[model samples]
Target: MYFLTSTLNLSVIMFLASLSIPTSGLDCYSCSVCRQPFSKKTTDTMTGCTVCSISQTWVDGKRVTTTRGCDKSCSPADLRIKGNGLVKTCCKTDLCNGNTNLRWFKSVVLFSGLIVFKLTHI
Candidate 1:
């Protein structure tokens, strides 16, 4: 009985947590040739997107082209072949795919805050 009750409580908590996330689609930058590293002031924006993507191609260790737009799929990947390949990043939040390093930092901070909140509340 204790195990069943605990499981039920956990399920209810998970459902409530999911509801805290936004349901509306994200607003993301949409451009055919977005500048490398991205700049919000210089790019077009789109709304109602499931994901934001940045696709960059490189040749001989030099960046060749960069594109940013809204995507239906959400697959984040980085591939290299002899210093020449494509680096594609996809993010679900608004403008989250703009800067790679900055996005990572934001993720870390958000995760840490969530952990702290849970610990303190529990």
Candidate 2:
């Protein structure tokens, strides 16, 4: 009886532990698809596309830096533009920054859970 009880407790603990882990290992921010400070290339020149690159600088007593990039993947800009309608913008259509790997993992986990539940119930 003790062995059976211990096995059941262990199973429950393992199940709860699985839930604690984030099924989605997606870095939504700072991803190439999410932080896309530029537009998709249509031509060789990347015209009208904005480009942004972050760099750290030491200023006076503080370390400060600015996000610099092109206004439209081609045009220069000093700050991040809001709703500028640039092509290939990250996080515009998808919640994740084009993280296909994370998406796949999430889907697999969801489906697997459903299958397990169905099997147990039926």
Candidate 3:
């Protein structure tokens, strides 16, 4: 029982600790006219960014351009311009804004804890 309790405590501590770790900075891609989904062609790599962002401009309901870069502050929003549109996307992970599917980090940590717990019990 003591061993079980210790193991459970360790698992909880590990999960909590992972959640509290502070990132010194985030890395992101910086580019003008970045390709959709993701592109290998980035103009530069940005470090120490608070957020990563992608902006898309559409003309007559068709996407015409994409831009990717690091941002100090960003909020996802859409704006319309005379039947055209602009969309801005924001994410907290490295290079996350360039992709259509944002990667979730918390879920991975929880899954890892569950795996560790199962392996320890077995």
Best by lDDT: 1
Model 1, position 5: C-alpha lDDT score: 65
What is the per-residue lDDT of model 3 for residues 1-122, given as tens digits with 9 covering 90 to 100? Answer: 98997788788767656543428777788888766656556457788888788787889887788888888887666685875998777766666655644233334435655866875686
TM-scores of the candidates in the order shown: 0.64, 0.23, 0.58
lDDT, candidate 1, 1-122, per-residue tens: 98986677677567545533547988888888777666778888899887777787889987788888888785556686898998777666787666646357446446745755764575
**Per-model C-alpha lDDT, please?**
0.71, 0.34, 0.69
1-122: candidate 2 lDDT, tens digit per residue: 98986677567557745643434332222322222333322111212222222222334433233222222223212232442222222221112322323234445446656755754563
- From the highest lDDT down, the ranking of the candidates is 1, 3, 2
Lowest-sum lDDT 10-residue window in model 3? 100-109
Which stretches of model 2 miss by more than 4 angstroms?
A: 1-13, 21-33, 36-99, 115-122
Q: Rank the candidates by TM-score, best first.
A: 1, 3, 2
